[model samples]
Target: MEDSYRHKGMRRQLVKVVRSKGIKDERVLDAIGKIPRHFFFENALVEHAYQDKAFPIGAGQTISQPYTVAFQTELLNVKPGDKVLEIGTGSGYQSIVLLELGAEVYTIEYQKELYERTRFALPEMGYKANFFFGDGSLGLPRFAPYDKIIVTAGAPTVPDALIDQLKVNGCLVIPVGNAKTQQMLRLTRLEGNKLRKEVFHDFKFVPLLGDDGWKK
Candidate 1:
């Protein structure tokens, strides 16, 4: 809960590292620099918080590496007041980043433990977002037509439900491939509801669990 001067300094360095990795969005970099990444880590793992690495949180999930978070956020192209749906909330670090970028975030998690923990923990740290517990790969249809969507876990394929929930011209950023390696993909919902897909770098993530994802 405490972010010291040293932590701020470390986050600055982490932002620089993310920038060097080709994350060109200054808004994303600013959010990375401003948030205290260590707050998402256990006391014992605080030393690894700003090292541009993913660390296990619990329930076989991870607080994504800073670079990965920044990469996805940049691809999301969040605009102020944009409605964003976040899948696999995990440690809630990425939600905080979207909030910092002035997005209205609706985040869902598949694990009950992580959902409950982050729901309480984030607001305690003065960050707020709509939190939901369910199968995130199915998408939060109750609040469909989001301006942007981000999936933090790897899926065997893009979930049709998520694409269906995006507003026309909305963007969905997700990793699609196998359980161990996924190619990051950005799918934009075009005017006719057709999708324009762009593939990016490969990454490894915990499998996204739900009906539309890997079987739990």
Candidate 2:
């Protein structure tokens, strides 16, 4: 519960690990250092919180590995005051990182349990985000045209709805592939609704569930 000196030290080591893994964004690494990842885990798993690995956070979702979080965030190229729509809240760790970078985050969670838990937990940790519960694949049309969109789950393909919600010149980061593993993709929305796609490393994530995602 407490972010002690030891926890801060652990986070510094994590930053180094993430940096070694090629996350060169200083802002992203700094945000990772400030957020207390252990706060998202139970007491039993707290010891391993700073490790660069995913841990289950109930509802069949896992807190994403720190490296993956940094990787996706760096690809987003988030700017201060950017309107970022996150497709999966999960443990809310990714949202917190974005908030630390001065982003106006609006995050959607699919599982009711995880959503309810994070809806209260994040603010308690001094992080604020607009939280919604529903099918993230549908995207949040009410608040469309986001400057950045990040999907935290693995999808069979990029959802068209997400691309539609992005503003011109906006960026989207997602993992696309089968249920087992996914290829990280960054899409920059160009003029005329065209997208510039770039593929990065591969990662494993929970299935993105919804009509536009993997079928239930």
Candidate 3:
């Protein structure tokens, strides 16, 4: 788990790439710049870590493109100490980003292998979040009412459970569409449980699998 100066330099360049792609939130950009993404990859594939592209992280999941991660994090509008729920922990990269933003994160992963791997890996990298192994599409109901929620996989539709878990004025950022591609959506929970929905960029993500998502 070595993050050499060369890796830090690559991260700086990666930040420039994401910033150029219209990620104006300096906090988001800073997180993108600070995280050692190479630590999430195997030594052989570390070179691909800062390329602004999504790469395989086993279990049929991806680490997501850097711009996409920044995009969603920007939409989340995290405040320091906000309680954030993250679906599809994947390689735990996004969780770290949320952590860097000063959010208390509760992240869940559906794939057992990824769940186990990230549960151990993140803390070892000096990043920690409350990790759970379960169907993320169902959200985490026991800890309902999060200040923000982010889903890393593509869903057929926005899961009701996630919306229900958001606090009033809270935000949930997810990509909703078919298995191949999804439209990035931001839903802000409003008074009376209503929502203000806004849609943004199209992205391709691995299918979200669970009771409320695509069937296994």
lDDT of 3 by residue, 73-168 (tens): 999999999999999999999999999999999999999999999999999989889999999999999998899999999999999999999999
Against the hidden reference, what TM-scores do the models get?
A: 0.98, 0.98, 0.98
Candidate 3 clashes between residue pairs 3 or more apart in a chain or in different chains: none
lDDT of 2 by residue, 117-172 (tens): 99999989988999999999999999998999999999999999999999999999
Clashes of each: 0, 0, 0
lDDT of each: 0.94, 0.94, 0.93
RMSD of each: 0.8, 0.7, 0.8
How many Å off is the CA of 53 in candidate 1?
Answer: 0.4
Query: Counting only residues 3 or more apart in sequence or on different chains, how many pairs clash (N, Cα, C under 3 Å) in candidate 2?
Result: 0
Clashing pairs in 2: none
The C-alpha stretches of model 1 lying farther than 4 A from their native spots are none
Could you tell me how far off, in angstroms, the CA of residue 4 lies in candidate 2 after the best superposition? 0.7
